[model samples]
Target: MTFVHWLAGQAGQTFASACVMTILVLMLFMAMKLYKSYRRNQTHLVLIIVLPLIIIQNGVLISLSDPEWSASPYLHIGYSFVSLLSFIIINFVFMKLYTGPASRLKGMPFFLMAIGLVVVTAAQIAYKPEMLSGPIAPGGVDLLALDFYGLILNFIILLNLRGVDQRINYQTSLIVYFVYQLSDMADSYVFHGEKPMLLIFIHLLPIVYYTLLFLLLFEWVLERLMMTFQSSITDGLTSLYNRRHFNKKAEQLLRDMKRIAIIFCDIDNFKKLNDTQGHHKADNVLKQVAEIIKEETAGIGTAGRYGGEELLGLIAAPGVKPEDVAEAIRSRVEKETMVTISVGVSISREGTSIAEIVSQADEAMYQSKTTGKNKVTLHPSVSQKRPRSESEGSKRSKQA
Candidate 1:
């Protein structure tokens, strides 16, 4: 064969291979996702398993058919079958991802399918079948009917692009599928039997389409896993690290540090505030205080909600005073939220247990509560017994 003829044959085989590979890869991902959802008891996502099956069936049928049969009546029947399956998949995805009137349009697919089948059948009977046996000629009824079905399917798929849940992976998959179909349709009319280079490139488009689908699926899966991890470690109300995550991280920090500071803070008269202002208002106060603590601890330590109306912070660094941080937090809470917090700070060196440090801080904080609200107190071991004015001057200097 001439090189040109050889290249054409290779291109055709490559197109078939691309379709087969795409089907295999899609099926693998769908199976993995299905298995994961099944293990999680998320049966709602199990229906997605059927989508890859539809694509696989379509690919297999297309690979088996000859290019010359592209517009033939039998080929039209194959296309109709694929279109119907696509409609089924689209309807399922729309209902699963969206709600309201659009989701209620479930029966529309069946209605359209029935009308399409009747119209295609009549068109095939009325027109000469021989005239439809090539790349979609202008007036060929078979190709027209197929094109009409494609347009309607694309319209339905496009509707799904709006107002659907942002987290749904199938959204990107459907978009890729729609673009693939549109490219196929464009190639049929615009590049049919064209230059060798253009034809080869056109045939290779499916490989790109399927590869994008795989990447989008991988991205979706990774995002979900990250979100799950974040939710587990974070406080839902204040977005601070929860107590469990805080302790786990603090233990790691303590092991690596020579000097560590632990600060325990509690809102004064918090129960009275909740009773007078309601739990909703109390929650707002907690959130505001958490934000202030987080801001104050930024770059110096990690802060978290230890329990109701209480927060804990860990600072591990040389030449940094824990008392300064406690005072900073106290002042910010008072200034920003018009509320008072009693803060207790403890500095630990070698041979100090996490529990011991926390206990010291808690004890000092209680001392502040007893003495007066909105004051910072250091553990007796760390306190220098400086005059009150000098200590206040030192705190102001450190804050500056």
Candidate 2:
């Protein structure tokens, strides 16, 4: 139960360091993958380079945990230098990523931090050159020098950046790392390894710290993947599902239920709207109509952008009428926006393919467009559906 034999001893410290090293190695591989995927992004390139340097620091700490080993004073200085500077620069990389990947990070903050790190490192050797004789562990006062500066630097960066950037996703990681650094600083100045429990905790902090950092990178990767997926499945302008994804949803719905419906909407005189009001204005109108369709179909079904000025809704709720949904879409477009729409709805039968259903809806929509604009029409094959007049749809919308 006690840590005296294992945790407080060299074995425990080495084990902890080994865990940190393992986490660092995994982070390195992730960094490599990111850099490989985005070769042009200098931020990833910086991560790929610095992670290996930090990993080597952990490897050295593991090797030197044994009491029998001795290292030169220069080696001690190198250890602190590598650990401090690499992590500080990596924090700069964090800021760069938040700004955007393509942004060059040659700002005043980076320049000042670079100069400050060099100055602190120089002061460490100047104040007390790693003694030529009796190479030993950095004492309490020694930690107050460069290591303390590193801690303060990180704290300041996070404090200021928290105000400047609202999208720092790795906040938990930063907090854990702050506590880890604080604990290490506490061990050096307060207990000085006299308390085995605190020493064990200090040794374990690296594992917790590095593990949190690794997870942060993993989370960032997942977020990027999600954004890519959303971009692929959704229209960039209206943010509705694209034609391909809409069809996919239709197929999936047809499989799950015995009946489904497709409401196809086409904006009236959309080419005139685009030509008269310009692209930006026409895009707003299209987006507004898409929003009406999405709102009317919420929960019962999904809405999508089928093409230019063309949007769709797929209804799968049992007992819900497709014609009613189509009318609501048409009435809303007429009342709410600068333009009106002609809509046609087709319900899926036992043997209808998604293409066939969409074709039927399109056919019905063409009939409405030819007869009158701003109307709802049902497929002729649906015996019970009565095509709603523009006045009836408007009255029903007013009633609702």
| Candidate 1, lDDT over the whole model | 0.66
lDDT of each: 0.66, 0.78
Q: RMSD to the native, candidate 2? A: 3.4
TM-score of each candidate structure, all chains considered together: 0.76, 0.90
Local accuracy of candidate 2 as per-residue lDDT tens digits, 1-400: 5656579767888888888878878887888888878765777888888888887887767655654443456566677778877777777766676555355445577668778878887876777754645667534236467777777877777676543233455565567777877877777777777778777877887788778667767877887889999999999999999999999988999999978999989998999888988999998988898899999999899999888887899899998988888887887788898788888888889988999999999988887788776788889877455676688645443211
Query: Highest TM-score: which candidate?
Result: 2
Error of 1 at 284 (Å): 1.4
Top candidate on lDDT is 2
Deviating ranges (above 4 Å) for candidate 2: 68-71, 99-108, 137-143, 163-169, 384-386, 392-400
User: Model 1: per-residue lDDT, tens digit, 248-353?
Assistant: 8788888877678988999988988889888999899999999988888888889888889889888886778888888888877776784678888888857887
